[model samples]
Target: MAEDIEEHEEDTPTGRKKGLLIGLVLAVVLGGGGFYAAFSGLLPIGASATHAPAPSHNADEVAFVALDPLVISLGPDRGNRHLKFAAQLEVEPHATASVSHLKPRVLDVLNSYLRAVSINELEDPSSLIRLRAQMLRRIQIVTGEGQVRDLLVTEFVLN
Candidate 1:
């Protein structure tokens, strides 16, 4: 009986050692994987020199960027229950060459769009969501297919 008890105690230590070895191995594997993932280059860097296109101006270039429209409420109270805003747009890099050709159409679109806006819509931040979509659509219509890729509001004044 004494010999059997000693044998059982010896087996218990061996089992514990095996369990500890397995746990250590698992920990090392998980730690190494986590380190590799942390160091991986999966995040995106937006609008940097590395991501943006190279700058160049050639004869085919068309640079006609009108100043942002002056937004004002044509009501009695300009400050109370009313807001005024000014917005400027940036021409797409690729469509820079064809921008001047479509200036008249672009101006017409801008005039119509600005005129259609109301003071209430300008005051609400949520209105900007629909406004951005509408602006992009209007610009696309004015410029025509593939002429403008993005509309950048360089200047935004809210009052």
Candidate 2:
């Protein structure tokens, strides 16, 4: 009976030690995995981290000039589809006057370019980026390089 008790006591301690070791290993593994996921941006909280805003090289020297909204009728066979585009031109604070002076030419270029686009092209989901680039290029050409910084498309509606 004494030998049986001794054996039982030994078994209990060894089993508890084994269980503790396994728990410690599990904790370590889980902790490491969580850290890795966070660091790698795989976790939702980590993934939500945003990039720091880019430092302004010109230091508040940027200005926006709102362009007149354009309403252009799509080409024939579209059955009265019209595209309304509203945008702003980003320019140097000092060049807002110069950029605004070219507004008529800018509007003319935009009108012609938009009119020339096929209805199908305007309907494509991926065409906005391309159209923006094209429009920016055209505006820069009219306003002269460096006079216009960027073209921000605020609204585009097709009906």
Candidate 3:
């Protein structure tokens, strides 16, 4: 009975702390080993993903065609608020001449669309993204598919 009691006393909270310390050390060592294995390319996952070079966007593959500046008149409620907008079209190097030939048509679409948009919509800061997308779609319709990659807005100001 005395031996059993001594055994129970030794098996209390003090022994639990030692087990917890060993577990924590093992977890840290294993975690570090796994990280080193992945980082050193011994493991198949992270090394290639982290160290691979990014694809470059060469200027030769794309070209920008600048549009003539546009000045749009805001209607009656806002007195003399003009939205001055300028943009460039990003297209394949081969498409520049064909796209530029259609500039008048593009301008007509932009002017008509901007004139139709409400003053509130023009004044909102975040509306540029929506506006840019809308303009790009209209431009693509006018220019045809695969001609325009993107529309880069160089200037947008309302005064």
Candidate 4:
């Protein structure tokens, strides 16, 4: 009976050790795969529906054009809410002229879109990300593909 008890204790520890080893190996492999995916951009950290990290550009080859700040009234449900937005368009240095020429159309598109949005949509914190994407798409359509690199929202205030 004493020999049987000793054998049981010895067997239990071996099984526990083997289980622990397998768990460790799985943890290492999963951790490595996560790192690989993140670094490879397969999993983008902090990316939003409307925003992504700008692609690399040579310093001398990029330019930014500021737009006039827009103050638009939100729909009446919120009792006199307003949005003040300011942003810049990034473009290739040579395309600055073209983008600048289209500035009026860009503002018109933004104004019309903002006015159409309800105060409730503007109130949600996540809405800014969606709004940014919508605005960027509209601006790009006006500016033509490849003319605008990115939209940098410098300020967004709701009052």
| Highest lDDT against the true fold, candidate | 3
lDDT of 1 by residue, 9-105 (tens): 9999999999999999999999987666655623232223124463564635533355445454445554433234334445656766577667666
TM-score, cand. 2: 0.63
Better of 3 and 4 by TM-score: 4
Give per-model TM-scores: 0.45, 0.63, 0.64, 0.65
Write candidate 2's Cα lDDT for 1-159 as tens digits.
999999999999999999999999999999999999887768744433443255565758879999999999885678988999999998989899999999999999999999998888899856777798899999999999889988889989999
lDDT of 3 by residue, 16-130 (tens): 9999999999999999999998888887665354454544669679888999999999866789789999999998789999999999999999999999998889998767778
**lDDT score for residue 102 of model 1:** 70
Which 10-residue window in model 3 sums to the lowest lDDT? 46-55
- Of 2 and 4, which scores higher on TM-score? 4
After TM-score superposition, what is the CA distance of residue 154 in candidate 3 from its true location, in Å? 0.7
Candidate 4: residue pairs that collide: none
Cα shift from native, residue 10, model 3 (Å): 52
Clashing pairs in 2: none
- Model 4, 10-51: lDDT tens digits are 999999999999999999999999877876677744333335
Candidate 2 deviant stretches above 4 angstroms = 1-59
Q: Model 3 scores what on Cα lDDT?
A: 0.89
Which residue runs does candidate 1 get wrong by more than 4 Å?
1-94
**Total residue pair clashes for candidate 4:** 0
In candidate 1, how many Å is residue 23 off? 48
